[model samples]
Target chain A: GAGVSQSPSNKVTEKGKDVELRCDPISGHTALYWYRQSLGQGLEFLIYFQGNSAPDKSGLPSDRFSAERTGGSVSTLTIQRTQQEDSAVYLCASSLFPRGPNEQFFGPGTRLTVL
Target chain B: QQPVQSPQAVILREGEDAVINCSSSKALYSVHWYRQKHGEAPVFLMILLKGGEQMRHEKISASFNEKKQQSSLYLTASQLSYSGTYFCGTEGFSGAGSYQLTFGKGTKLSVIP
Candidate 1:
């Protein structure tokens, strides 16, 4: 079975630049989540999408962050005007359903570096 | 809030045993444990629900204490393959039907043969 996959394993951009991270969840998975992991600090929840329902955006740090899951399969996390603080690994995960106690398969992650 | 993990790091012999604990200030619905080696994706180990159910995977087992808002992961006769970072993720219900996970800083376990 194919696991979740993310594109651009590493991204380097200058400050004030915009970048897009892509995530392809496992086949038949209806729930996708985006998280950021910084050094020393633990993983931080960004956004989550379950099927066609409204995505959970509470974890997005500011207005510059946004995500969209298209057709219930793939998701794209966009950060506008990248800041140095945004330098971290962006991870994507997916579960079979939108329920608790389910295993979430994670992708390789995209490490973003803002210079 | 993020759960607090004790003993930020641990080192043990291949045949030794170790325990990692995670405590949360808020009530929890479930506890999920994951292990990840350097430069690898996190792999789910097990999940314990709110009923204090204890789940086991190989030599790894976890217990959830709903009343105390705590969970513990026990590694018995640890193996070299067990060397990695252990993360405990606590899921709490927001309002309506939303549930999100807050992960601890993680416990780094090193197994020496």
Candidate 2:
């Protein structure tokens, strides 16, 4: 089976620009999550989408960060007015369910660099 | 809050054993373990629920101590392939029936042959 995948494995952009990172979760997985990993740091939860319920945007660092899962399978994370602080690896994960004991499958991630 | 991982980094011989620990300040619903090699995606190792269950995958095992709000990952006879950063993700109940994982800083394990 195909694992979770992200597009544009690498992205380098100027500050104040907007960048959109895409994620394709595993088929049939109802739970999707977006995370960010800064250099030598742990994974930081950004947002979550479970089935048709409202997405959890609590982890979004600022108003400029947003995400939407379309048709419950693909998710796009958009960072408006990117800054140097936004340079990090963006990871996407999916699980079979939302609230139970389930393992999340991760994608290769998109390395975004804001200059 | 995010969990805290101990021994930020460790080095072991191929035949040695190692243990990584994760602790949280808040009550935990589950603890998830993952290993990530450099420049690659993180791979799930195991998950332990709130019941304080222990799980094993190959020579890798984990124990969740619900009462203590902590978890430990045990790797026996460490192989070179085990050289990677191990992370513990903690999940707890938020408001509105929401749940998400908060990962620790991670433990970097280097298994030398």
**List-wise, what DockQ does each model earn?**
0.72, 0.76
Residues A1-115, model 2: lDDT tens digits: 9999999899999999999999999999999989999977899989888874545788899999989888889999999999999999999999998755689999999999999
Error of 1 at B55 (Å): 0.8
For candidate 2, give the docking quality class from DockQ: medium
lDDT at position A59, candidate 2 = 89
Query: What tens-digit string does per-residue lDDT give for candidate 1 at B27-85?
Result: 89999999989898989999899985689999999899999999999999999999999
Backbone clashes in model 1, listed as residue pairs: none
Q: Where does the lowest 10-residue lDDT sum fall in candidate 2 chain B?
A: B92-101
lDDT of 1 at A57: 74
Global lDDT scores for all candidate models: 0.91, 0.92
Distance from true location, Cα of A33 in model 2, Å: 0.4
